[model samples]
Target: MKGPIAILGARSLLGRHVVNIFQELHPDVCLEMWTQSDGVGNVNSVKRLIACISEAELIINCHEARDLSMAPDREALHFHNEQFVAEVLRNSTAPIIHISSTLVQCSDFWPNTYEPEREASKYGIALAVKAYCKSKHLAEQELFASHRSAVVLRIPFLYGEEDWGSPVTDAVMAANIFGSIPNIGDRGGAFQIIIVGDDTPVGDVYDNVVEAVAKNPKRPMSTYNLPFLPLYYIYLAIGWLLLAVNKIFDVSGSLSKMPDPSLLYLIFHHWTFFNTNKSTNLLPDHEELSREYVVKKSRDHYALMNPNRVRTSWQLHIE
Candidate 1:
């Protein structure tokens, strides 16, 4: 609780937020950061990471390929995700907390998986996403198979203050900035999604990691699903529609950015979002927020960014 904690992918939204959470929760704890932009997969970074592992009592891996549409080939993903993890396992004796995705549950590629849903091979998931899922699945498999002390948090559509990017963020922008609500044709929002960590703030994830590390269970690894977000299909629909409009019209007057439709469909149509019975049982202090709570928080953040708003005579700061 008072020493060093090394974090990989520190530049990522999750990584940055986790670092903040550590500082807030454990003021005395020392933090070491590594980022892909800093050449994490390079030889020098390996040496630094190895050194970090040697000194730190805990290591948190928040690295992931966020862009599914432009990801490298499968082999490259494996090298980045699987081989990188293997290297960490080889050098580190400290317990690791790996941030993984719930999308892996959709595929049969991962043997001995705990997902309740059937394999999603028939679901027509995009090629890049399938590769991404395979990469994460393999990493999880590697961690467990290595017989090391690790904990895997299978997360879903994460949204909170200072998010780097996510489908939920896109939705917030559509609603708050463009004044366009997502509408999925005539589906009448006949869709269900279980957004893990949707209600729980990103800081809570770090808190859970800290608590798990404190316990130091003798088990090699434990896997737990985060909180399930209440389904709000219509809102997500609006986000998707807005994203679609942005893509076709290029109305943003910049890079045409939006969550891939395949990914959106996967979350809204295919993936089975579940309850956080396991996480809640283990970490009782973590709270669950309603959709209204997240929506309101997002709106407030955007309001401060609105150009027409005047707060303390300060100009709006837009991302």
Candidate 2:
């Protein structure tokens, strides 16, 4: 008999979706959600988390600090997981699938290889972003070292319908409604936006998680990046310019009410994209996500939900 599949950090945006998908996929399989803070109905304590983990057949770690600014505080960045992850590895005989980022592949220096299996993230020191990358690198190293059954998914630039506040959502809304967007830097700058286009949808990630749970391997400790999305910054840039103009004029544009000049540079200026050949070959259900489809879906959904609303920040009120 298979034990229940426990999802850590189930209160997260991705975590909530995964929980719903898993229930629909396997109604007979018991599902448990755990959060560091008070969870859905009751307060999920450390004891409860451990108990649930002890009995679960599998664990999926969706607990990640999305804010890159927390890099200065190492403990907070790791989420006090020095013993938590190790504890899980020690207690559970089941495979643990951890959600990681493609930033770990980035080097503190430069001339970084987009490949993850190459072990290119050797350097780790700098600003909040670099520190965040280093934390992920070290975490993965420890996880692989601790348990061979552990698996890591290095996702890059995730966008989906559930997150209506994402930068992509802002760009799409501004484009479809206001026809205005802003460029963070000079148009003719030498900084070429090189994204692996590994912008996977949450739905695809959900499917991969379901598959991993179904096939619980004994010695399956490995990290895999989701399929890549090709670079399409030009189209986005045009959209931003339109939104930026509307913002400057103080129009009733949806994105105009939000931040001006856009925050797309956070990703466009950097190269955290990854090579997904391994994930595509390994995960049979893995598919190359269509950036257009995702953007359209997010745009349409947000328009319907908040036709007159505009968001300046992608902040969430976690309980």
Candidate 3:
């Protein structure tokens, strides 16, 4: 058997993408999707989630309410997730993979270098990231305490088709036909990226989850940032080009909408992080890391998207 499978909160934007990928990988497989959409802010919503955990052999939870604008009821969300993991460990034997975010990575980065450990920006965006870390940590710890088979895949910033208003989404939207970017005073801090590919770093996170399920062993939880090839400079160049285009054509073209306080700053500041080195050690023999491979893949992806005013990639793919 490839595996027993289930996904929670499968109706959300991210959840839908997850579902699409899972199905694409395994056709003819029964995929059960559960949502806490109605009355999700209450305890009963989570109780429904706990009940569903009882019947599954493997569960991948991609549930989240990420909004930088509104302060979430962190305690409520934390309690619900914590209890859900606790219940899964207590009643069922299946392993679980909980989706987390790079917002949780705490690393330092040196100004003159890409030494994240030495010069981390985790603190820079720390406040914006706190609640996500707290809730995910609560649930992860319980999975460990109960000796459950589970892993947490802390995804960094994701850039792909079908994402609307995502950090990259705005940039992709704002790309100008002039092949130039307007001068924007501020450049955003760096966020780590995870490149999706076959036999990917995800294999590492899943290996642990699968092993835990098979062994019923208590494992120490660790985090890895699936670093991408495009550094902060790549995004900065894209920003510069946009400003130049706006200057040349006297048009915003596909550039991002300027927010009232500052449109460009808001777009530039949104970032995520991850380190895949740790995960690299755990993958099966079939997959290997190649910096060149990822860069090539990403470059092709950007070209295919074609950041030109003539083609509406945003409307076609990102909405």
Who wins the TM-score comparison? 1
Question: Model 3: how large is the Cα RMSD against the reference?
Answer: 13.9
Evaluated against the true structure, the overall lDDT of model 2 is 0.49
The worst-scoring run of ten residues by lDDT in candidate 3 lies at 208-217
lDDT of 2 by residue, 1-319 (tens): 3548889878665677677766755678888777767332233555677777888888987775543321134554555333456656766777788877665555423533445554534543422255455566666777889755887877654444555344444444444453433223222211111112224422222232212221123212124322212223554465566657665674334432322221233333333335666656644241454655544554455445442463323322221
Candidate 3 lDDT by residue in tens digits, 88-186: 566567787777654444422212122222122345543333454566556666666777677776655454333333444333433332232222322
Q: What are the per-model C-alpha RMSD values against the true structure?
A: 12.7, 12.8, 13.9
TM-score-best of 1 and 2: 1
Deviation from truth (RMSD, Å), model 2:
12.8
What shift in Å separates residue 162 of candidate 3 from its native position after superposition?
A: 2.2
Could you give the candidate ranking by TM-score, starting with the highest? 1, 2, 3
TM agreement with the true structure for every prediction = 0.62, 0.60, 0.52
TM-score of decoy 3:
0.52
lDDT of each: 0.52, 0.49, 0.46
- Could you give me the TM-score of model 1 versus the true structure? 0.62
Model 3 regions more than 4 Å off: 38-51, 69-72, 79-84, 87-91, 107-128, 170-189, 195-273, 278-319
